[model samples]
Target: MLFSSLLFIFQFLPVFFIIYYLSPIRFRNLILFLASVFFYAWGEPRFVILILISILINYIAGIFIERYDRNEKIRVTILVLSIIYNIGTLMFFKYFNFIIENINYIFKGDISFIDIPLPLGISFYTFQIMSYTIDVYRRDTKAERSYINLGAYLCMFPQLIAGPIVVYTQVSKELRKRSYYLKDIEKGLRIFILGLGSKVLIANNVGGLWDDMAQIGYANISMPLAWLGLLSFSLQIYFDFNGYSLMAIGLGKMLGFDFPQNFNFPYISKSVTEYWRRWHITLSTWFKEYLYIPLGGNRKGKLRTYINLFIVWSVTGLWHGASWNFIFWGIYFFVLLSLEKLFLKKWLEKNVILSRIYTILAILLGWMIFAITELENIKIYFGRLFSFSISEDWIYYLRNYGMILVIGILFSTPFLKKWYDKQANKILCNILLLVIFLLSIAYLVDAAYNPFLYFRF
Candidate 1:
């Protein structure tokens, strides 16, 4: 169920929270596990089995890995089997159709497509399981012995669907022993309300602008309109995903777990390298830790480092979706990042205004690539973006969405957050939050144009 949906917000959450806190401390995990399973089953009844299979496989594998730690061969074999099972399951469900279509296209064969329904959050939970098994193999963290704790961790509904990709080690302690504090609950509630406002007030509203522009057709779009559409899209994606991350983190806090922060003010960065560090911080860290570092990373020398980046980014793009355009989007960033590492970083550092302009333009262009999937459509849209043309429709949209665009841009930076931090007006803060909450509720009640863009991923 979507966190923004009234069913979830009004019914499921209230009921779950009441039951969760009322239960004895010992039965808390059991309650959470059952509730999470129900939550997943509510949307994906058949595919809930897939998640259970994953939990069982990883849970057993972790124990075996720990049991056979003294035997190098047995331990390695178990770890390798666990990785294969997790990745193979993910590949089959998420990429099997993608692979078959590509094969048919290349060989001109009539391969029957496997019409498999991708289990919701398969990509996320698969990675979480793999991380746990790998950590167990490396002896970085102890294998979780309790099936209940591990199951709850894997199926935790808050971050389960879309994730900061919570690692097993991060919440292992909390899973075993955690306490509820009034201050933490209050803080979490505040963060949750802020995130709700961001998604409902900013992301959903601006996204409608992009949707309207898209319906007008790419070929007919003028240069200014193209940029405007892209700007709306960039803001829409940022606020949507970042808002979800904040809600997940806040929910984690309320449950007495501390999930890591997923995003910083990435749009404020002056370099592509800096942007990656701030944007989707957890996923980037995952690739660096599990993929890049293992592939010899920068320690292997300059050329190998570039090759490693290429491999990482190619996979990263594919991870986002099963599409060629996503791959191109990844490579596009790879090229920009490589150039920055080579010499652009030095040049950008010397000129502040120029660097900001370059970074923003680069990001805007990248979003253009990421937003469109078909090659022909990409060509047409980009042609318009650079055509230096204008139309009356561009002016119309500007007149309509100018204030929202301004607000989106301002919120992209840390201006409001910094201002709020300096204020000692607790009452003022509460009042503002209440206003935002009420506005969000009104939007939710109307339910006009709410879209969670990253739901597929």
Candidate 2:
């Protein structure tokens, strides 16, 4: 269930955390594992079995890899097979229909596309599973002896669906030994409340403006409104995903597991390369560690480095979805990042304001590509964005959404966060947190547009 949903916030989470806190230390891992399975099953019951397959396959593979460590060939073979299994299952469920449709279009063949359902969080949890096996293969970490501990690590509900993409190493120790503290619970609750405000108060409210533009038709929108609408979406996606990440981190904190930071005020970045460093950080770390470095990261040569980037970006694009637009989005960034690496880096670094403008504009256009799936609609939208057309229609939306947009813009940087930190322990700040919590709950009570955007990925 969605973390923001009233049912999850009020019912499932409360009941589960109560059981979790009351459970004895020895049985905690088992309780967490079972609760996680139930959580996943609540939304995708059939897929739970498939995910169980993943857990067992990887878990067993880790053990075998560790067991056969003296035999390089055997260990390597197990690792390769496990990788193939994880990637193969991900491809079949996520991209089978995507591949079939493309094939039908190209070859004039009527291949009836099977109705396949993607398992919930397959993209996320699969990466975590593969990381564990690969680390064991690399001797970076030992394979866990306890099946229940591994199960809980893989299935923990907090970062299970949308993640900071916690690697197995990050939580292996916590699985083996962890302690609960009242301070951790209070701090986690506070962080969660702020994230709720970010998603519900700011992201959801501004997101409606974009939806309105879509319904109103991009063709009829003036150039100014097109930019505004895209900005709204930019804010919507950032806060939506980042807010979800924060909530996940907070939940992790409460459970005595420290998850990695996912975002770092990416909008403040002056370059796309820097932007990436701050945005979806764990995913970047994953690609860098497992894929890029293995492929010989920049230690090779400039030409090879560019080629390496191309491969990473191509895979990164496909990883987001089984769509050409996502591919284009990846290539778009690849080109920009490549240029920055080649010549523009020096100039962009010196000119902060101009670089930020350039970075944000480039990011917004990239989002435009990401926002639309159909090429024709994408063309029309871009045309509107730059047609230089004038209309007073934008004024109406600006009036309606201006304040939330301002709030989103401010929060996207570190300004609000720094200010909050400065006043963190003050009575006013505490009251503000309470008000945010109460308002978020009220919004969820009557919520309309509360979808967590990254769940599809």
Candidate 3:
């Protein structure tokens, strides 16, 4: 269920949190483990068995890796097998159909595609579980002994389906021992309200324009309209994902756990490199720690470093979806990042206004590539973005969505945050939070169909 939905906010969360708070501290993790499984099953009943089995496999794998620590060959072998199982599971469920279409195109064979659903949160929980076993193998952290503790850590509902991707090490302590605090709940609820506003009030409103453009047809849009639509999408995606991340974090805090920050006002960035550093902070960190650093990172020669970046970006794109467009999106960023690394960074830093403009344009174009899945449609959309065609249609759209768009852009920066920070402890601030919460609830009552953009991944 969507975190933004009235049903989740009104029914599921209230009941879950009440039961959670009443449970004994010793029983909390077990309660969470069971609740999370039920939460997943509420939406994806068919995948419950799949996730349970995957969790069991990883739980066993971690123990084995830790057990054979003194024997290099055995531990290494076990680690490799675990990696294969996790990656293989991801491949079969997420990419098997993607791979099939390509093979058919190449060999002209009429191979039937598998009719299987990608298990809910498989991408997220899989990575989290791998981090556990890999850390055990590297002796960075101990393998969790309690099956309930391990399961709860991996299945924590707050960030399970959509995540800032809380690494095992980040929450290992909390999984074993944590205390409830009223202050924490208060702060976390306010943060949750803020995220609720962002998603329901901002992202949902701005996303309508992009949906309109899609319904109208890409080729028919004027150049100005095209850019405006993409701008709406750029804002939509950032708020949609960012809003969810904030909710996840807020929930974590409420549960007496502190998840890492996942965003840093990426839109304000003046360079693509800076943007990547800010956007999806956790994912970037994950790749850097697990993938890039292992491939020697920048410690390698210049060519090797570039090659490592290429591999990371390619995989990063594929991680988002089982589509060629996603791969292109990754490559697009790779080229921009490579150019910035080569020479653009220095030049861009010299002029703030021009640099931000350049970065914004680059990001909007990238969003265009990301939003459209079909290559031919992507090509048409790109053509429209630069077509220089003129129309009054864009004026109407801007009139309709201009305020939310403005709020989205302003909110994308630290402006609201700065103001909020200044008045955080004041009574007015408390009232404002209440108003935001109430208004967000009201919005959901009328419009409860919000869909998470990253749900596909």
Give the alpha carbon lDDT tens digit for every residue of 158-237 in model 2: 98998979999999999989989998998898889888888899889999999998899988999999999999999999
lDDT of each: 0.90, 0.92, 0.91
Per-residue lDDT of candidate 3, residues 1-457 (tens digit) = 8888877898989999999998888989998999999889999999888888878888898899888778999998888988999999999999999999999999998999989788887888888888888888888889989999988988889999989888899998888888688999988998898889898889999999999999999999999999989989999999999999999999999999999999999999999999999999989999999999999999979999999999999999999999999999999999999999999999999999999999999999899889999999999999998888998889999999999999998999998899999998899999999998898888888884588888889
* Clash pairs detected, candidate 2: none
TM-score of each: 0.98, 0.98, 0.98
In candidate 1, position 389 carries an lDDT of 83
Ranking the candidates on lDDT from highest down gives 2, 3, 1
Q: Which stretches of candidate 2 lie over 4 Å from their true place?
A: none
Q: Candidate 3: list runs displaced more than 4 Å.
A: none
Q: How many pairs of residues collide in each model?
A: 0, 0, 0
Of 1 and 2, the candidate ranking higher by lDDT: 2
